[model samples]
Target: MDFSLSGLWHEMGLFARLVVIVMGIMSVTSLLVVGERLLVSFKGMSDSKVFASKLASLLADGPGRLDAAADTKFGKDIGYLGRTLRAGLVAYKGSVHGDKDLCFESVARALERQQARELAVLKRGHGWLATVGSTAPFVGLLGTTMGIITAFEKMAASGSGGLGTVSAGIAEALLTTAFGLLTAIPAVMAFNYLAGWVDARAVDISEASNEFLDLVARRLADGPSEEEEEGEESEAAA
Candidate 1:
């Protein structure tokens, strides 16, 4: 019997074929997830940097500049940080006229909620990669177990206990294990890399949110600026 992949494939039983097919699907799906997550991570980082730069300039201008956040265009290009900041700004604006502590608390809650949501979005699809990394090897082992059983059955029927009688079967059985490792290693690596990126982004968001809260505290301490008062008056007039 030919021991090449094609030859081994032909000799494989139905269960073995199904195992290969399942592993193949898993491999393809993992690659797709890796590509998608890398794209998202990179783009999100870039957009966040831009947003942060712009936000720094706005904050430097004065707390009243927060009004500009309402006019800022938010979309995929704005990224997660922009969304979180917008949520905080919206809360701050709505509650700025209320009790100072209540206003701060409202902004804090908004930031926290948005941060959790953004983290969830960043972690999307990670579970699948983890599942494949952890389970692919076991799935392959299951196929190998079935192949060995089939081989032993053949040997019993042939009334042969020779190495040659079982060697081919054992080799075919090991093939699934090899494929399983092949599928799993890359998935594990990808999951680790993406997880690191997500962790770093989480830190960035935490720091940014904290800084934003500090800015809010300072603004409240100073009370509403003249520009903010004028803006409110104009809105009230309208």
Candidate 2:
């Protein structure tokens, strides 16, 4: 009764083998998701930093610089901050010369919508990881139950029940259990880590939106620009 891996593999019945194959697929899918999320998280963070720095510089120059800033390559990137800021800016632009209240409301709605979309993107594939983590063990338990049933069946058939007759089935149960834990531990860890990253990004986007709105408020309070006032005066004189 060799308790080695190859020996156990050979002894696994059809049901046990099917369970192992399913677990292997789950493991591979979890790994791929983890890698993709990590890559996206890191790239988003880096691009957001660049966009933030550029936005700050433009904002410092004055609210008038926002249009140009929004048109920049950085603003068009797929990062959370860039997309959110661009959405708000586009909304503001459409209503800039009209009602200030409407402009602010539009910008706020745009920010909220962009934030939801970005968060949703960040959360993609997270559910599957959670499902794999929570259910893999139970799946393995099902296999173990089947293996135990087979073991007892063999004992009943042989009529001379001994350790040799049942060890293979017990080995299958233990191996499946071990593989389940192996697949689940990393999946749970990755899900937690990625969730935290998404939260942090959300906070950053919220703060950026607030800062942008504050600038807009200041611009509105200042009233119309000198050029607009001059043009109105010329029209009146004509």
* Winner by lDDT: 1
How does residue 15 of candidate 2 score in lDDT? Answer: 91
Q: Model 2, 1-238: lDDT tens per residue?
A: 7788888878899999999999999999999999998888788888878877777887787886765665566535557788888888888777777898988888899999998999999899999999999999998888889888888888888996899888788888888888889888999999998899899889989998998998887777787767668878999999
Q: List runs of model 2 lying over 4 Å from the truth.
A: 71-75, 227-238
Q: Estimate each model's TM-score.
A: 0.92, 0.92
CA lDDT, every model vs. true structure: 0.88, 0.85
At residue 160, give the lDDT of candidate 1.
88
The runs of at least 3 residues in candidate 1 whose Cα sits more than 4 Å from the true structure, single-residue gaps closed, are: 62-64, 69-76, 230-238
Clashes in each model (backbone N, CA, C under 3 Å)?
0, 0
